[model samples]
Target: MRRVIGLVLLLLSVSLSAQALSWAYAFVVLDGRVYEVMDVAVLDDDLGEVVGEVKTMADDMDGSYYGDASNMYPIGTTYRKVNGEAIEDVLAVEDESGWKRAEYRHDAPFSMRDHLDKVAYGFVGLGLVVFVMYRFRRTR
Candidate 1:
């Protein structure tokens, strides 16, 4: 029983110690309101790197009805970590009163930068595999 409890504690600690993914923030001034974006990227910090992304509209009312027919609406921006490897996607949808709603997917690895790099390498490997297959097919 004691060993089980110790194992459980160790698992919990490992999960808790996982670093948070860092996100890049992009800001724009639109109609006197500041709109900020969150996307995957490397964040400079003492702990090395962090990754994740977010977009925020400040001091704005939260409602969908206010968006109006005009397309001056706030749309989510796309973010790619480690050049153009993994993409962190976000979308903005109109809510009850012209308010923009943020919907995000939180399934990517905690280290956006590192994971993105891995993605890059994976793509390279995939490309090589495709090339080899193509060459073999052509030879046959």
Candidate 2:
């Protein structure tokens, strides 16, 4: 019973840790408000290393709408982390160099980051399987 409880706790801790590391954040000024982006990336040279982000917008008077940026933002624009507010509520965007600020906006989600994480997990899982199998065969 004790061993089982300990194992469960260990697994829970690992899952929580993995969840914490899985998401990445960036900030941009879209329109006028500041927004914390769930995912962002530097565009390739072919795209000019500049990205035009399309974000969702809403106001009290106007209904929710989607807005696309007219200007392109550099991929590596620098941003500083902000504190005081809850992590989820705080948007990390640079006012000057990191990123150009516009109104608060929610950009289209980036999937490449998610794909990369899955790929990394795949390689790690493969490596562990090979190592375990080798050890088992050696013992036999």
How would you encode candidate 1's per-residue C-alpha lDDT over 1-140 as one tens digit per residue? 99999999999998887563332432432222223333322322211112322242222332111111112334443222233322233223232243232223333223344356679999999999999999999999
Instruction: Please give each candidate's TM-score.
Output: 0.23, 0.32
Q: Residue 30 deviation, candidate 1, in Å?
A: 42
In the range 13-124, model 2's lDDT, one tens digit per residue, is 9877642122133334433334554433312221222223434222223222233312223334433333333323333433333333222444434435435667999999
Q: Say which candidate scores most in TM-score.
A: 2
By lDDT, the best candidate is 2
Candidate 2 has an lDDT of: 0.42
Candidate 1 lowest-lDDT run of ten: 62-71
Q: How many residue pairs clash in each candidate?
A: 24, 11
